[model samples]
Target: MFMNWRRIRKWHFLRLISMCCVVSLLMVCWEHVDHHVVSHMKSYSYRYMINSFSFVNKSLSVSQEEAARFNSFPYLLNQNNVCKDKDVLLLLFVKSSPENFERRQAIRSTWGNESYVSHELGVILKVVFVMGVHTDVTNSFLLQDLHEEHKNYGDLVQQEFLDTFHNLTIKLLLQFRWMHENCAHARFMMSADDDVFVHMPNLVRYLQDLRRRNVRDHWVGHVHRGAPPIRSKNSKYFMPFDMYQWNSYPDYTAGAGYVISGDVAAKIYQATLSLNASMYIDDVFMGICAIAAGVSPQEHVYFSGEGRTPYHPCIYEKMITSHGHENDIRYLWKAATAPEVQGISSGLVGKLYCTAVKMMLLCKPYFSNTYSCMAAFT
Candidate 1:
């Protein structure tokens, strides 16, 4: 035993340290493999691109800087500075033309008749996208406040008429945040673009069910492990950052997406107050705000960007909402209320053929102005 101890003591301390180092490295690699599995979504490259932009120099003018900083990417905004009631789920839209909204109303009156606006369902307080609005949209934003005899709106009505609107992504959040702070009776808030075709009736059902389960978490159209941010001017919305400095962000539901629960929205809004803007669009902004808020984003699996698909086979599934392109808002109504499919098999996923062409012909006369969809679209 004494001879064996002598041999063991003879080993070099440096050799022992090297062995320990190798073991530590292997353990780290193993732990990482076990804990941080990579996912197969196509967005990983975009994530990498965004991180690269962080290395760029930040050298824009103060005014231009503010414009550039807030302008960011993906969604545009009007310069209007305003406040909204907290109790309402504000649906903000940015259009090159506000006049188009009038025509949109015509489209709604003509075909919106088929929309599902149930009392217990999701609700929207649609507003102009800030970018498209005049530089002073904020003055108009105070319409509900100027007539203070009836109401007194706060934060949203900031002191700026020339101020460009916050990004739709940010504006929606701003609206919700302003309201939560202002409205006491308000229980929840959601922000979505005008283009998104939301299934309000189903959303209401989901919310009611969620409430029963006592769940209060923020949900967005969720993407699991988004790759690094990609920086490209051609893409409408781009991200520029390393896999965010943090290991992960609460999966972000895109800004065209919505937020739920007044408290979480409020918390996120507060989280964003001091958060410096990021290079990527909504998702990055959301990542920063979520991180600042310390509120982990919960992925609501039902959210989709598939548009009319919202009304298809998943029609019976639980859905908070989904995304649709700016041009296809009316298409959703047409797809959902197609009288022919009331009880038939789910036909929304089928190929668009001559019938679709015929539908367009029927819809052309009235919709030609600003309307889209076949005559039978709604």
Candidate 2:
């Protein structure tokens, strides 16, 4: 009787262990299923939001005549006369005002200096300043100056649209048109503002890596996802309900600097033909068109959107672009591309040092907006 009782106890123990193992497996499977379900739901939500705002199909209420004019707009300034001989790898289109001559000159001397980039990096880079006509027609001197500048540099691409804050979309459209017509064969293209500072060495290296990997449909920069449109009338970014009813704009890279593959650029140009170009905000409008073209914008944590990134060696090591550098671009460029930074080893120890430096500098809350602060850390 004692032996039988002991055997029964052992059998019960074995059953219990089997049940526990089964439960553990079930829990793991459940967690995976839940994660997949959540991912699918998020994707569906984004698609539904985009479709909700797609009210018109291939019809633009905003000046059909102006839309038609995009294809045939004569270039008041052009780069075809100069860049015809070079097999360009990256074509940078900088959005500049007609009067920002000093800022343009600063850019030309620093990060936007194509000759320096090509000679140093051995990568063919072309820089073009995109502009529109001056709003005040009486400012003939500015126009004459622009003409002279273009004649000397052949780096300006200007259209007839009035250059104003509200007419930024026109400027962007002009860039797409010019890219399509002239530099479509380039491997990649970037749209940047005149005041922004680009780290040419880092950016060129990143693009070269992408090319080596044979990456396509690539659009990357500081991505803003689920960004709400400003509703306040007094806001500079005010969007009335009639203009955009959606609660969030499609994911878009910041206009301060964003890069797209040549194919993606062509696709965005085609998207412009079908979508209305009425949105005044160029970056957000680019997002809309990109979504329509089925191109997704990817986030690069190093790309500073509209805000200036805090200067640090760790930050500059991986930085791509920073905004609000109108006066300090040359200095910033010098610091970023210094020999010390270029020679930093990529070994584990060097990486650990940079990581520690970043933790010390970026772990704190900096920006007033909580999201912005978190993004800085990221």
Best by TM-score: 2
lDDT string, candidate 1, 106-191, tens digits: 33432222233323234434333332334545556444333341132111122222223334444444454445444423445555
Off by over 4 Å in 1: 1-99, 102-132, 135-173, 238-250, 278-280, 306-320, 325-331, 334-378
User: Where does candidate 2 stray beyond 4 Å?
Assistant: 1-48, 51-66, 69-73, 343-349, 366-378
C-alpha lDDT values of all predictions: 0.43, 0.79
Write model 2 residue lDDT over 92-198, tens digit each, in one string: 99999999999999999998898898899899998999988887878989989998998888788887778888888888888888888788888999999999989
Q: Name the Cα RMSD for model 1.
A: 16.5
The TM-scores, one per candidate, come to: 0.51, 0.81
TM-score of 2: 0.81
